[model samples]
Target: MRKMIHSKVVFSPEDLIVVAGISLQMAYKIIKELNHELEEINKKEKKNYIIFRAKIWRKFFRERYYDEKFLTINDLEKKFKIKEWEAKEIRSTIKKELVAKGFKFIKGRIPEKAVLEKIYDYSEEERKNENVSKIVKF
Candidate 1:
């Protein structure tokens, strides 16, 4: 995958054909349906639109579908390249603090914000802090 999921990640019409292997007509129809649904979802934004915001068209299908937002200590250790004990400690610390911040989770699962904030630093503009992040599978 050339693209990684982000706050504003979306695909283009050409992406549908090349990546998804759908017909051009089907792509257009799908785009129409997606736009209609998105408009309904963001009704306020649809009403008074921001011209520079490129609201013309895009395929934002991840948030609605792919949801693997939590990870275990083992998962964190492997993904973040940290020691198992460190991962355990970090998860322990984050879990305690997150309870006050309205974050709920299972016994060994922690939110991916553990990946987002603690591991990979995200800026105010939704971009990564330094170079490329490990989220991209090379």
Candidate 2:
């Protein structure tokens, strides 16, 4: 199993309640629920999860734009017949959620997960190289 070092955080009950906007008991319950569901997550599911989330946004944009022609925000609003503010809110909400989930999203653009994977690969390679040089010198 791969291990990750994460900084420990200590939070008071009230502080956590305020941050999550839930009572301590409820927060604990939610965390318990999440923990149970998270047990199923692994590398295979993680890859599919990111892809699934991106595909959802892709579908949202496609459906929001009603016309078969070039679709703009105006077309989106007109097709959905929703207000401009509503359309804007939907887009913002989707982007915000993706970011919170560690998925980078650009307006009118979707970044490939390979970009983040490459960054991780490069950092790991650098660490390996450093370890090798240290061993050689010693």
Candidate 3:
């Protein structure tokens, strides 16, 4: 009987065919291309996020305090205790966002007299409906 010793770096004849391999240059190129694509995607995502955030902010503000009489920048600053620049930015962002969302926000002065009444009426109706639902559930 003859004994054969196999080296640690043993390979079959098929191993000489050399399967697919990537060089350093090709790897760098692929990485650079991926990075470029990621940057472009991030820019687009940022723009979309800004546009969506603006729309949401406008909607929430309007729902909470939609004044037909648009609040002036100064009034907004004072009311929110923010800087004049911030107020301007908020108004601009809101206007642009609302326009994008197809909500035409026109600047007009409405009488304050009926606003309070309307708000009270809306609240009362909401409360009544809530109570009715609670009773029905009970």
The whole-model lDDT of each prediction reads: 0.54, 0.40, 0.40
Tens-place lDDT digits, model 2, residues 32-135: 43334334453537633222211122222222222112323454477568787865665555456556765433234222222222324454467799999999
| Model 1 regions lying over 4 Å from their true place | 1-68, 123-138
User: For candidate 1, what is the TM-score?
Assistant: 0.39
**Full ranking by lDDT:** 1, 3, 2
Shift of residue 52 alpha carbon in model 2, Å: 24
- Pull out the clashing pairs in model 2: none
Output the number of the TM-score-best candidate.
1
Q: What tens digits encode model 3's per-residue C-alpha lDDT throughout 93-130? A: 66664456544332421112123333244554677999
**Model 3 TM-score relative to the real fold:** 0.30
Give the clashing pairs for model 3: none
- State how far residue 21 of model 2 sits from its true place (Å): 39
Q: Each candidate's TM vs. the true structure?
A: 0.39, 0.26, 0.30
